[model samples]
Target: MIIRELITHRWGNKELVTSPSFGTVEKVFVKDDMRVLEWEPLFIIRTENGSLEQIAVGVNGVINSVHVKEGDHVIPGMVMAFIKDDLLDSDIS
Candidate 1:
């Protein structure tokens, strides 16, 4: 996938919002280097008033790495993980 399109919404498209803002890591549902599907929850974040929000993987890819664990603080635009496209020929069929 185009990394530029993944980061910048230049085409009215969707990409993983890696960092919405500094928030506490509430839970992690995915593991490192694992295959994930689009719209799958990768992490749950405790952002406002102890409320939990899920961070989803916007595309199908392998979890290259995880940067934070539960209770860790995150930053804006920080690459929590890296994902490479798992495009199969049949995906378009």
Candidate 2:
């Protein structure tokens, strides 16, 4: 029998982000339709003082879409992109 167990991620397919501090979107290392591994840095945020912070993908998945780019403004709790995992199983909780 063919079996397909769907495992959904905690944040779903959407990758949302919230800037820890007031910063400008600096660089984006990912784009639409890109695949990423868990804990991979997706982008960087730079503050006025030239310090940078990296945003990472918490799960392994494909990038479905990108909502922001370099030089974009980052807001608290904003959706950055959508991601779809490659594997699924009933063990998802």
Candidate 3:
């Protein structure tokens, strides 16, 4: 299952998306407190093989954490960010 669905379901598997290999965070498109749509580009990673990969938000939610910043080397299973699923509608808008 995708990250979005897993998060929405309270992470039934608790699995995370990892890089196929080591890479560095090239760019961050989303920030904390931002409302993101499902599958939106959250960041980009540049692999050692010179390939650029776009990491997208798995679910429609607000960004809660940003673990790695630009130019930071990241490994597989690294938590790039946390997305808090907006499961309920609140009147505090």
lDDT of 3 at 11: 45
Where model 1 places Cα greater than 4 Å from the true spot, the runs are 1-17, 88-93
RMSD of each: 7.4, 9.9, 5.9
- Return whichever of 1 and 2 wins on lDDT: 2
Clash-forming residue pairs, model 3: none
Computed on alpha carbons, the lDDT of every model, listed in order, comes to 0.62, 0.66, 0.65
Error of 1 at 40 (Å): 0.4
Off by over 4 Å in 2: 1-18, 87-93
Candidate 3 segments whose C-alpha is farther than 4 A from its true place: 1-20, 88-93
Tens digits of per-residue lDDT, candidate 1, 33-86, equal 788887777777776466667777557866666777888888767656666556
Kindly provide the TM-score of model 1 when superposed on the true structure, using C-alpha atoms.
Answer: 0.69
Query: Best TM-score goes to which candidate?
Result: 3
List the pairs of residues colliding in candidate 1.
none
